[model samples]
Target: MNEVFARGPSLLTRLCIVLMLSVGAMVIDTKVDNLSTLRTYLTSLVSPLQYIADLPGGLLDWSASRFNSRQKMLEENSRLTNQITLMNEKLQRFVVLEDENNNLRELLDAPVREGMYRMIAELMAVDNNPYSHQIVINKGAIHGVYEGQPVLDDTGVVGQIVEVGTTNSRVLLISDITHAIPVRISRNNIRMIASGSGSLNELSLNHVVHSGDIQEGDLLISSGLGNIFPAGYPVATIINIVRDESLPFASITAKPSAQLDRIKYLLLLWPPDIAPVDALSPSDELTREGS
Candidate 1:
C-alpha cells in the first residue's frame, strides 16, 4: 500500500477523490441558496489554471446576433428602393397623359373644321435619303395602323404609310418623287396635281397651263377628289410661280405645309371603317378572281 502511494496515486484512489468532491459540491449547493453565486470564487480558488473556458460559447452567440441584424437591414433597404422607383415611374406617365388631353381639347375648340381624327405614333427612325422626305414610325397593324393611311402633325399632312409591319410602319413623305396630292388653288378653285420634285422643302405643280390663275403665296387645300386623303387639309402653299409665255405650262414651286425636316412625333388619321381597298391595289385581284 505504501509502494502504491509512493507512485503518485492508484487508479481507485483518484476515482474515489473525484466522486467525493462532486458529492460535497452538490450537497453544499442544495443546502445553501447562494451556492451558485459562490461557485466562481470556489472555482478560482480550486483551479487557477483555466483561462479560456467560456470564450468559445461567448464568441458564437455574438457573431450569430450580428449576422441576423445585418441581413434584415439589407432586405428592408432593397424593398423600399424598389417601391420608390415604381411610384416615380407611374407619376411621370400620368403627367404626360394629362398634358396630351389638354392639347387635344384646345384643338377641338378651334375655329377650324377638323374632319380628321388623330392617333399618336412615335417617330422611330429617320431615313438618310436626301432625295426623299420619308421616315418611320413605331406603330403598325398591331396598333391598328395600316398601309395607305394618311399621317399628319399639328400643322398639316405629313405623309402616308407605304410599308406596314406588325409593330412598325414606314411613311413616304410628301416630298418623295413618287408622292402627289390633289390640291386646288385657294383663289379660283382650279384643281391641279401637286407632284414632289424630290426635294425636302419643294413640290411642283404640274399640268397647270400658262394661263392658270394660281399666284405666288396662294394656299392649296386637298380637294378630296381622290379617296386617299380627307378633304380640306392644308397641303402646301405656293412659294414661287414662273409662267413663261414660250412654255406650254407654268413652272411652279411650293413648300410643304407639313414640316419635313424633323418629326419626333405625329398623328395617324383613322378612317371610320377600314374597308378593303381592293380597287386600289392590284394584288386584291386574286381574291376577286378566286371568288
Candidate 2:
C-alpha cells in the first residue's frame, strides 16, 4: 500500500520532462516527415468518430426539411379546394342568370293586340293549398295592377288577379276548380264553357251536346263574351269527348294551352280604355319593387 501511494518524481521534475517532450515533438513535426505519416493515420482512424459526432445535427436538418415540404403541400391543397368551391358557386349563378334571360326574352315576344297595354310580372310565391290553384305575383295595385286584371304567359291566358296588396297580388290560376272561362271552338265557332277540373293539366267543358261539331283536336279560344278575358287568346284544346246518352251533357276534357305548372313569368294586360296613364315600364317597376 505504501509503494502504491509513494510519489515517483517531484513536481518540478515532471514539469521539466513534459516541457522537453513537447519541444522535441514540435521539432520533429516541423523537420521530419515521420510525424506527418503518423498524423494521417490518426486522422483516418478518427474519421468515423467525427461523422458520428455530427449525425444528430444532420438527421435533425433532414427531418426539418421533410416536415416543411409536407406543410407547404397541405397549405396548397387547402387553397386549391377553396378556389374550386368559389368557382362552382359562380358557375351556378351564371346558369340561373341565363335561364332568367331566356324567360324574359320569351315574355317580351308574346303577341299583344293593338290598343292593349302589357307588362311583365314575375311569380313570387305559390299557394300550397291543394284545394286552390293560386300564385302570387310581384306586381300589385301600387304598380297599376288591380283585382280581376288578366294574367297570361307567352303561350296563352294563365289566370286573373283575385287579391291585391301594395307590393304583391294573388292570381287565381285557370286550373282552379272555381274558375271558368267562355271559350269558342275555332273550327265551327260553337261556344262552350271551359271550367277547371281541379287538375293542372285538365279542364271540363260543360253542356256540350252529343251532336256538337266539336272534335278531339279542336282548339278553344276566349270568346270575349264575359268581358273578363280578351278575345282570340288560346284557352284550351279538346282532348277527349265522352258521350253518355244516359246523361244530358257530354263529358269533355280539355288541356289548358298555358303551361300553368311551369310558368315563371306572366303578362298583365290592360284594355285601351282602362290603361293607366302613370304606369311605369315593366323593367322600371321591377327594379323599384325589388329595392
Candidate 3:
C-alpha cells in the first residue's frame, strides 16, 4: 500500500520524458523508414479495434441519412399530388370551353331566312317530371321572348315556348306527347301531322292510309299549315312505314331532325313583321340578354 501511494517520479519530470521519447520516434520515422514494418504490424493488430471504436458514429450517420431521405420523399410526393390535382381541374375547364365554342360555331353556320330575326339562348333547367319533356331557357318576356315563340337548334326546330316569365321561359319540346307539327314529305308533297311519340327520338304520323306514298328514308319538312313553324324547315325523317290491312292507318314512325336530348343552346326566332325595328344581331342580342 505505501509503495502504491508514493509516486516514483514527479508530474513535470514524467511529462518531459514522454515528450522527448515522442519527438525522438518522429525524427527517426522521418530520417529512415525504419518504423514502416513495425507500423504495418501495429496497424494490422489495431484495425479491428479502430473499427469497433468508430462503429457507433458510423451507425448514427447512416440512421440520420435514412430518416432525411424518407422525409424528402414524402414532401416530394405531396407536392406532385397537389400539382396533378390542379392540372385535372384545368383540363376539365378546357373541355367545357371547347364544347361551348363548337356549339356556337354550328349555330352561326345554320341557314337563316331573309326576313327572320334570330338570337341565341342557353338552357337553364330541365323539367324533372318524366311525363313532360320540357326545358327552361334563360330568355323570357324581358328579352322579348313570348309564348308560342318558335325555338330551334342548329339542325332543325326544337319546340315552342309555352310559358314566359320575366327572365325565363318554358319550352315544350316537339318530342312531348302533346306536341305535333304539320309536315310535308319532300318526295311527293303529301302533308301530314307528325305527333310526338313521348320519346325524344321518335315521332308518329297517325291516321295514314295503307295506300300512302310515304316510304322509309323520306325527308319531311314543315308544311307551314299551323302558321307557327315556317315552310321548308326540316322536321323529321321517315324511318319506318307499316302498311296493314287490319288497321285504319298505317303505323308510321319518324326520327326528329333536331337532337332534342342534347340541346344546350337554342335559337329563338321572330317571324317577318314581328321582329322589332331595333333588333340587334344574334351575337349582340345574346350578349345583351345574358347580361
Clashing pairs in 1: none
Which ten residues in a row are the worst by lDDT in model 1?
Answer: 282-291
Q: Supply candidate 3's per-residue lDDT for 253.
A: 97
lDDT of each: 0.71, 0.79, 0.78
With a 3 Å backbone cut-off (N, CA, C), the pairs that clash in candidate 2 are none
Winner on lDDT between 1 and 2 is: 2
Name the lDDT of candidate 3: 0.78
Q: RMSD (Cα, Å) of candidate 2?
A: 16.6
Query: Weakest 10 consecutive residues, lDDT, candidate 3?
Result: 282-291
Best by lDDT: 2
Q: Which stretches of candidate 2 lie over 4 Å from their true place?
A: 1-114, 278-291
TM-score of each: 0.55, 0.57, 0.58
Each candidate structure's count of clashing pairs: 0, 0, 0
